[model samples]
Target: MAMITWITDDGRHRQAEVNDGSNLMLAATFEDVPGIDGDCGGCLSCATCHVVVDAAWAERVGGPGDHETVLLDTTASPRQPHSRLSCQIISRPELDGLVLHVPAEAW
Candidate 1:
């Protein structure tokens, strides 16, 4: 299983384990972490699951696609260069251990 660590705006940390094919949003939702709402059930329609991946993992994760980029524009939090909509990210064997941080809010 892949491990995903979540850091809150105020410096709180929460971690979730992802199965080989699990996406970051689903893993976070399953773990009941506070920041990710995942209201669209991993459909990528909502930006509630927005997160900022750690800089070290940024290149490994890559940037969002056009569709995901558009959605990130609607996020409640201010968009950043490293912003990502967690729902669009699918965890694979290669992403065995990923760490993401939640922004202050998600609209």
Candidate 2:
């Protein structure tokens, strides 16, 4: 399992041990991480699970896909250089300790 950290806009940090191959949006909801509302349930249809990968871990996490890129633009938070949809990010051993900043709003 990979240890993922989600930092809220107000500076709250929530960590969870996510199984390999599991998308972050599902894991975040299971762990009760605030600010991640997975409204579309990882269907890549909603932007509620938007997150800004920590700069230090952005490269390892890589970039979003074509459809996901467009969805990022609709996120409640303005897209950042490292912005990504949590549902598009899968957990893996290489991603241990990954950090994702959760915006205050997930509309």
Candidate 3:
């Protein structure tokens, strides 16, 4: 399992052990992490799972794809340089200790 840490906009933090191959949205939802609505489930249709990869893990996590980028533009929060759609981030052993910052709102 990979240890994923989620940091909320208000500075709250929660960590969960997520199985490898699971996407970030699934991990967060499974653990009931606050600030991640994931309104559209894992579909790429919505930006409710928007998050910003921590700067320390940005390169390792990479950025969003073209389609995801389009959806991110519609997020309730302003998109940042490290913005990403959690549904699009597939977890792996290599991302064992990934850290993500949840926006204040995702809709």
Candidate 4:
């Protein structure tokens, strides 16, 4: 399993052990991480799971896909250079220590 951390706007950190291939949006919601609302159930339809990858982990986590970029534009929070849709990220060994910053609102 990969260990991931989600920090809220107020700095509340929620960590979880997620199995490989698990969609990040699902795992965060299952962990009861505030500010993450996977309204589309990881279908990539909703941008409720928007998050900003910590700068230290941005290159490692990579950027959003073309389609995800379009949706990122509609997120409730102002998009960051590292903004990504949690649904687009999957848990994997390489991302074991991934840290994502949750927006103040999920809309």
Candidate 5:
């Protein structure tokens, strides 16, 4: 299992132990971490699972994919250089300590 931390817009933090091979969206939604709606499930269609990966872990997390990039253009929150769709981030042993920042909203 990997430990992932989510920091909400209101400055609240939530953490969950996610299994490897799953995605961040699933982990967050399963843990009921606020601010990540994941409306499109993990399809990369709705952009509701948007998150800003902590800068410290940016390179390890990497950037969004082509489909995720296009969908991110329509996110409710402004995109940051580190903005990414949580659904696109697959959990792995290397991501055990991943930290993500949730936006104010994700419509």
Candidate 6:
């Protein structure tokens, strides 16, 4: 299992233990973490599961795929260079302590 932490815009922190290979969106949803709506479940259709991957972990987590990148472009919040749709980020042993910061809102 891997531990994923989510820091909200209001400074609220939520953590969850997810099995390796679990999508970050499902991890947050399973933990009932706020700020990540994940309205489309693990699908890339909705940008509600948007999150800002901590820059330090960017290399490990990797960048979004074509589909995720397109969905991110529809987000209302200011998209950062590290912006990613959580659904596209699958947990792994390599991401044991991945940290994601939830944006103020999801669209």
Model 4 has an lDDT value of 0.92
Query: Candidate 1, which segments miss by more than 4 Å at Cα?
Result: none
**Lowest-lDDT window of 10 residues in candidate 6?**
35-44
Q: What value does the lDDT take at residue 31 in candidate 6?
A: 90
State the C-alpha lDDT per candidate.
0.86, 0.93, 0.88, 0.92, 0.90, 0.87
- Model 1 is weakest, by summed lDDT over 10 consecutive residues, at 89-98
Estimate, for each residue in 1-107, the C-alpha lDDT of model 1 and write its tens digit.
77788888888888767887778888888888788899988887989999998888899899999999999899999999899999878887667667888998955
Compare the candidates by lDDT and give the number of the best one. Answer: 2
- Model 3: ten consecutive residues of lowest lDDT: 31-40
| Candidate 6 lDDT tens digits, 5-85 | 999899999988888878888888889888778888876787988899999999988998888788889986878999999
The TM-score, computed over Cα atoms with residue i paired to residue i, of candidate 1 is: 0.93
On TM-score, the candidate that comes out on top is 2
Can you write out model 2's per-residue Cα lDDT over 1-107, one digit (the tens) per residue? 99999999999999999999999999999988888889889999999999999999999999999999989889987899999999999999999999999987877
Positional deviation of 99 in candidate 3, in angstroms? 0.9
- After superposing candidate 2, which stretches have Cα over 4 Å from the reference? none
lDDT of 5 by residue, 1-107 (tens): 78999999999999988888899999999989888888878987888898999999999988888888898899899999999999999999999899999999866
Position 90, candidate 6: lDDT = 83
**Candidate 2 lDDT (Cα, whole model)?**
0.93
RMSD of 1: 1.1
Clash-forming residue pairs, model 3: none
Decoy 3 TM-score against native: 0.95
The reply for model 4, stretches above 4 Å from the true place, is none
TM-scores, one per candidate:
0.93, 0.97, 0.95, 0.97, 0.96, 0.95
Candidate 6 clashing pairs? Answer: none
Sort by lDDT, best first: what order? 2, 4, 5, 3, 6, 1
Better of 2 and 5 by TM-score: 2
Candidate with the larger TM-score of 2 and 4: 2
